[model samples]
Target: MTGKRGRPSVSEALARDERVVDVVIALLTGDGIEALTFDRVAAEAHVAKRTLYGVFGDRTGLVRAAIRRQHAYLGDAGDGSSDLRSASRAILLHLLGDEAVGIHRAIIAAAALHPSLAQEFYDEGPGRAQGFLASHLRAEAAVSPELLFAALLGEPHRRRLLGLAGPPTPEEVDAQVDAVLRTFGLLR
Candidate 1:
């Protein structure tokens, strides 16, 4: 019997996409974005180059898809809680996590040469996180969500990027989250 002419079943397609993104993330973390090529991704992902082209079109599209996949946790609404502090802590935790730190380093290094990727990263990663936090904050708060996020990340994030320190421990993340929230008057 003949089968569908185009694409696999939805489940299979999703699984393939997930695998591709996972491979991309691993490459980015291990070798930085400069080393992430479609050829390499296809070889490692065990998907045909044509399949990657069909799903992602090109290197940029594949990188963007990978970034979007990594940002999925940031896109999630937490516990349906209205508390800004809770939201802030969740955002900080995700942002400071090991995977996020690695992706951030890759994006920053990639963006130095590819300016367009900077905008894409901002829109999809930090921009989304900022919007999420802003939605949970009081309108009258003097601090902007962007600044709040920066404060939450602070020097530790920079240190991580520079290979001067490892990903912050959960206690460190909570402390920094509290400090930033307190500074912004989001926490009592």
Candidate 2:
């Protein structure tokens, strides 16, 4: 059952890892990756230390799980299942959103020390997103999907990742996606 007076019962706590990962996400975005210790996550999630370790193994595992969670959330956007315009807009908005930018900044700060984590982040995050965009594209376009992905992010993403700007509004996302699609000859 409960390991401590304030903590949730183990069965109840472990039932939804989302709660724990959500806490980790908040810590990651709000205080940067340095704040992702098991102590902090367990306390914030009201779970026991044993629960965190039993579920996520160690700090690296914990961080990896959080990154995976982020990837899962962002992966929904540009799945190629939707129409091109909608998919592209969704991808741009999600990529340039506050949480993605925060996670990106945190990962960038930690990447030098955790190269493998960074590589995994890139592979699963932007790499996967680009792959999705590629699937949505026609074969006739001269621009590679990678180039289109870059243009979608472009200056807005850079500004967001650097904390120089906030998340773009839907109108801004629309303008950027329309311009990029037009430039790439994907739009008429």
State the C-alpha lDDT per candidate. Answer: 0.79, 0.79
Q: Write the per-residue lDDT of candidate 1 for residues 1-188, one digit (tens) a residue.
A: 65556668989899989999989889888898888888899999988899999889877787788767655655555445547766777766676667777878888888879888778778878888788778777779898988887887788778877888876777887788888887777778
Residue-by-residue lDDT tens digits, candidate 2, 1-188 = 83445555667655558788888879888998789888889898877799789888887676777766655545555454676677689787777877777788888998998887788778877787777777777777788878988998899999888789988899999999999999988888
Q: Each candidate's TM vs. the true structure?
A: 0.86, 0.82
Worst 10 residues of 2 by lDDT: 71-80
TM-score for candidate 2, please give it.
0.82
Worst 10 residues of 1 by lDDT: 73-82
Provide C-alpha RMSD values for all models, in order.
2.9, 3.6
Q: Which candidate is the best by TM-score?
A: 1
| Model 2 bad stretches (over 4 Å) | 1-15, 68-80
* Alpha-carbon runs more than 4 Å astray in model 1: 1-6, 77-82
Tell me the lDDT of candidate 2: 0.79
Q: How many backbone clashes does candidate 1 have?
A: 0
